[model samples]
Target: MISVESAIIGLFSFSIVLLALSFFKKDKYKELENQVENLTMIVMQENYQLKKKMKVLEEELLGNESYTVPLNERYETNGK
Candidate 1:
């Protein structure tokens, strides 16, 4: 016994509810994206620091004379 006009109104109301739910989900997705960006920046900064520390260690090791012994001389000298 439902009238055509009433059915149309009910369908419109359901559409509006679905639209609002989609909008709310979009906002939540944006918030999660911001959190991920922040965490990525922190990880990148830590990675850069670690790379710098590794470079310094490599320089120190390369600067030592004992570590630079020529291959030919090593065989000529007694295994001291």
Candidate 2:
């Protein structure tokens, strides 16, 4: 029952609506992508900082000054 001209007009209207919707959402999508990238960079920096801190702590723990008591004297000094 639809005429060719009416069908063409309907198709054009649908295309315009879709284009408008896409245009409106484009900025929001770009903003989300940028936020994700920023968050990823922050996480990577935090991970690097944590790794560096852990290395320093490990080195400090393994230093000779940490074990002030000799192995044999430890049991004699402590009741445990």
Candidate 3:
């Protein structure tokens, strides 16, 4: 048989624990969001690096060619 004061105390403590749990859950969500943003940034950096590498490779390949330019490529290069 709980006294009135004991019941009130128990309920109050329960509510406090629930609020603490909610706060921790929100913090976890923020941590996960930060991790996702970091991963996205890493992927963007990798994509930029890959594009630069591919451009260099293309230039090297083109430089090795001694043949005359194609008609379309010549027109495009002249920007007309």
Q: What are the models' TM-scores? A: 0.57, 0.56, 0.49
> What lDDT is reached at residue 77 by model 3?
73
Structure candidate 1, residue pairs in collision:
none
Tens digits of per-residue lDDT for model 3, 1-80: 99999999999999999998887774667789999999999999999999999878877877865335775886687796
Per-candidate Cα lDDT values, in order, are 0.83, 0.83, 0.84
| Tens-digit lDDT track of model 2 for 1-80 | 99999999999999999999987774767789999999999999999999999878866985754355666776676666
* Candidate 3 Cα lDDT to native: 0.84
- Greater-lDDT candidate between 2 and 3: 3
* Candidate 2 least-lDDT 10 residues: 62-71
Superior candidate under lDDT, 1 versus 3: 3
lDDT of 1: 0.83
Inter-residue clash pairs, candidate 3: none
For every candidate, C-alpha RMSD to the true structure in Å: 5.7, 6.7, 6.7
User: Clash totals for all models, in order?
Assistant: 0, 0, 0
Clashing pairs in 2: none
